[model samples]
Target: MTCSYASRARFHRSMTRPFFSKDRISHFDIFEKHAEDALNQVKGRLKEGYPVDFQDMVCRFTLDSATEFLFGKCVGSLSAGLVYPKDSLPGQNREYANHPSNLFARALSEAQSRSMLRSSMGTNWRLAEFWSDRIQKDMEVCHRFIDPILKDALERKRSTKEGEQSTGHAYAEGKGFLEDTLLGHLVNCTEGKADEIVNMLIAGRDSTASTLTFLVYMLSQYSRVLKRLRAEVLSTVGNSRRPTYDDVREMKYMRAVINETLRLYTPVPFNVRTSTEAALWPGVNGGPPIYIPPNTQVPYSVFLMHRRKDLWGPDADIFDPDRFIDERLKYLTSNPFIFLPFNAGPRICLGQQFAYNEASFFLVRLLQTFSSITLAEDIQTRSPECDKGAGRDAQEKVIVKHHLTLYVDEGLWVRMGEASNSDDV
Candidate 1:
């Protein structure tokens, strides 16, 4: 028999599976609608000759949709209509500065930065206590921000127990979701005792947003690729209808672009594995076996592994999505360990498919709405000096930096022009 921890984890996975399943995913049409609302907002601004920071737009879009998927409500970041702050970065635009949601989003960013820094510090991570008091305060803020939703969910569950209408849990129950929605299923599965609400907030928000941010940035830099992608999206999804799960699956090129995006810039660049018990493994170069004592943490860099010259050949560093369609495709089936954006084995992300569905839907909506995106001529690598006029030299290029995930340090600022061939939104 499996141990309690193992069994509990297995049960949790089973409980959560329904929430991210393809069938249940379509029911979350709100994801697509929310994506459209955000995109249209940006498209209107761009039509008026505004160059929007696409990364921040993606962040708000993902935040609103993910929260809606997790809870039954969304923050409506697109509706907040806030501008960039006084000390904002060079390319970033004004953001939605609403209450609760704004504080919640800020807290998420802080906790992720601190968590990344702390993990990188190894055993010295505790030293961050002096610098990371803000993380604690942020968590408190996040909890407070999410508190009312939690209470309402709990009360709804309680009401259902008293034979109240099961609108909250009805769809999930009919479709075999764990509880009703993600929060409901998780709350029910853990007996309403776990501190998982905050965990879900972090898990549901960051990774997907970062992926889309980088993907849009990369798309802007490659017009030929972008043109082809839009063509495929138009042919497959078109102006008349919305894209379904099968429609996205049939989008082979779109799939390739997203795959390449994940390959080149795996959001969570490094993951740490800690051994709970002593272990021995085969040694390298015909040497004797190596020993790994208990409590040892091994860090593997997905960012480096994804771009290995030997694995991907000389053009490993290149941004060619066709590589997925042409060469090296077979190698993935033979050696799956080399590319681990969402990780592998038993701990693979439960939301992986959900993320894919959401992203594909958003891309479909975006390409359908906007014809072309142009990277600003002044775009440059992010730096303290980049904020000044003299710092944006022609030589500067986009650079990747890591915190909880890899993000374009300077931000992806682009100008979107209406598609001449397409009907107006």
Candidate 2:
């Protein structure tokens, strides 16, 4: 979809309104605000010596934001600052809200669930079964969350149906995204389209959250880089007001910083696809043919490719946002596969632009408030233990695992302090 500033603004306003008025998913609208708010919240936590739990915060933020956009009401997570309402109805809470017992609880919960399922499962069709269950669970949550809203919307539609002039078509005027779409696609998509929306939320929230966490951690590790980033943010965005979308777009250094973070700590580390026909991959001599049956799985490890020494050089492991400077990337090869944090090919992430806006806005807000980010003494002592599961031998490794998406075994914890008083970097 071609995302326009006007379109984003419209979606943002639509989400805050009582009725879900559009038939399309407007992720940019929902993510823009929450991303900045989330950064501020995380920065506060860091300054107070609170452990950075990206998984829990990301899951809840993404879920609630996506839910609000899809259903036209806050999920009570983001606005209320609660994962799940403690006094909510039990069965309803499990189905509609993010349950503590569910995989939606934290990053570790999801990682561990996938790990256990992978290890103890039957090799024959375990993956298929797990995927099926996951889909079912996603559908259940979507339906429960949207059903009541949809019903109310439909009722409102019916009340205004007789009086309103239609193109000989019966439709709901003040319906949410689900109802608006149903007004059109109720014929073809006989199954739960609500689940489809949930699937999109599932795909978006955690990955973005994980990426932001990594970005913050990296900023802390490279304090000097964070200083430059803050200078750039302050110069471009200023401190008098929060940044707008346009301000975020103009901050070149902040943009590069986020791009570098995606390269180094990709949230979705790998993607699997089955080749429908015999195909040739790069790097092999003579373009050697690789055989694949219809159902054969092909794994493309993005993490490995992003950290490829041939593409990024000896300093590939270094957290240097300057690598993204035009002078640097200009000398780089034009290979598309060099970086795939959001994937490449036909099935790349659709919410890429929105994610960028949110991440940038949040980072800008964070740096504006904090002077510096450093590793706490206690956190530093546990670095080895934390890094054990973090998937690599980097200075800030934490156990990272590929469940459905990549997530740290623990969380991204850091210490943030006041920024340098000097406005100039």
Candidate 3:
């Protein structure tokens, strides 16, 4: 039987305290290494003259960072330097050897997709997952692939407590932020730690990766936005050194770009909630309130809502980072419900700040390292369905797929290179 729904919620609430504060998750060298790995992936792919898979690069980067941040051990997705070969074994088709935890990443993706399918099934969701052989296999793979890593973390934490603290401490000495992570605090966490840790990993990995993937894709298409962001990064971070936690916060335009991207793409386009008791939801424009019966499931689309003309004005659909900075901003702070990228409740993402830090750090490093990112000419665009009065063309439209989060229907393919002028920005 499942237990601790309340306890798990409480645990996340407790976890959020350290995760959200200004300098909280600040000491993160794991993020720095993974960010470098992401840049390196792009660099390698650029030299090959083939379009780099922005999706895979960010996916590996997030997987590595999330694992190390949460479990005290890295999954090594980026470090392996492998471009996963289709229709081949883990390490079979690339220059770099694949990480063994590739199985874990694949399993986690499959599991999330399967769960999304089930969630779309209303009250009878479990029956669908129960009946599907593919889902059952996904479950098995997840258990087999991720359990050992969880066990290792638990063992490491246990050992550290039992006369090994001095050893771990000595090892952490002189390594910047070596122990500044969530892992060290979990030593005394009892019962349900596995589930809690895995839940965090699932939240931590794909959402950030998907956001970064889409951000890069959007930036390539929206060069003006990228230029401004790169300028902000250069002005704040400079080219010679990696950014500190404080440096990321000071980049106003970078934060605006991220907020705008989150507004448009919102990794989890919508979320669902079931009412345990009857309730009333107020309607818009002074309309009558609507009553919701008990056991009713309500789904709200943050993506569609964010683009509404009523809230965002005539050019609501336009990709503009300036809105967050100038007079156009509202709803985010004034009316929270209309703009719930991370949702508006106790269960709101505990790692939201962690995600911002990770993204900001990487973007700064990326701007410092690369001159330009452009859509690869060899790659075809996804066709648009009915502009229905909008002026934008079919090719400029984005096509996305929904699992637990959104992904580009076709992988985001782009070309990148070293910056021509370090002082340009």
lDDT of 2 by residue, 1-425 (tens): 12353364344333323222222433255665666666567666555545545555666666666555544555545443422212334213544444432433443334435544554453654656754654446445445655776565445555545435555544445433335432222212233223344444565566777787777767766778887888788888675457776777788888888888888878777666655555545545667565556544576778888887778877777777888885568435466568777776545565676677667766776677677766444533244554454334746545555566666654544556655456455
Question: How much lDDT does each candidate structure score?
Answer: 0.72, 0.58, 0.72
Could you tell me which residue pairs clash in candidate 2? 20-176, 371-418, 371-419, 389-398, 389-399, 389-400, 390-398, 390-399, 390-400
User: Candidate 1 lDDT, tens digit per residue, 250-314?
Assistant: 99999889989999888888887777678999987799998988777777789889988788777
Question: Which stretches of model 2 miss by more than 4 angstroms?
Answer: 1-55, 79-123, 126-143, 146-192, 280-290, 331-333, 377-394, 418-425
For model 1, the stretches where C-alpha displacement exceeds 4 angstroms are: 1-11, 82-99, 127-132, 164-179, 281-290, 379-396, 421-425
**By the TM-score metric, which is better: model 1 or model 2?**
1
What shift in Å separates residue 174 of candidate 1 from its native position after superposition? 14
TM agreement with the true structure for every prediction:
0.85, 0.71, 0.85
lDDT over C-alpha atoms for residue 167 of model 2: 50
Model 1 scores a TM of 0.85
lDDT of 3 by residue, 225-335 (tens): 888888777777677578987888788888999988898788889787767678898987889999999767788788889888788777777788888888777645577
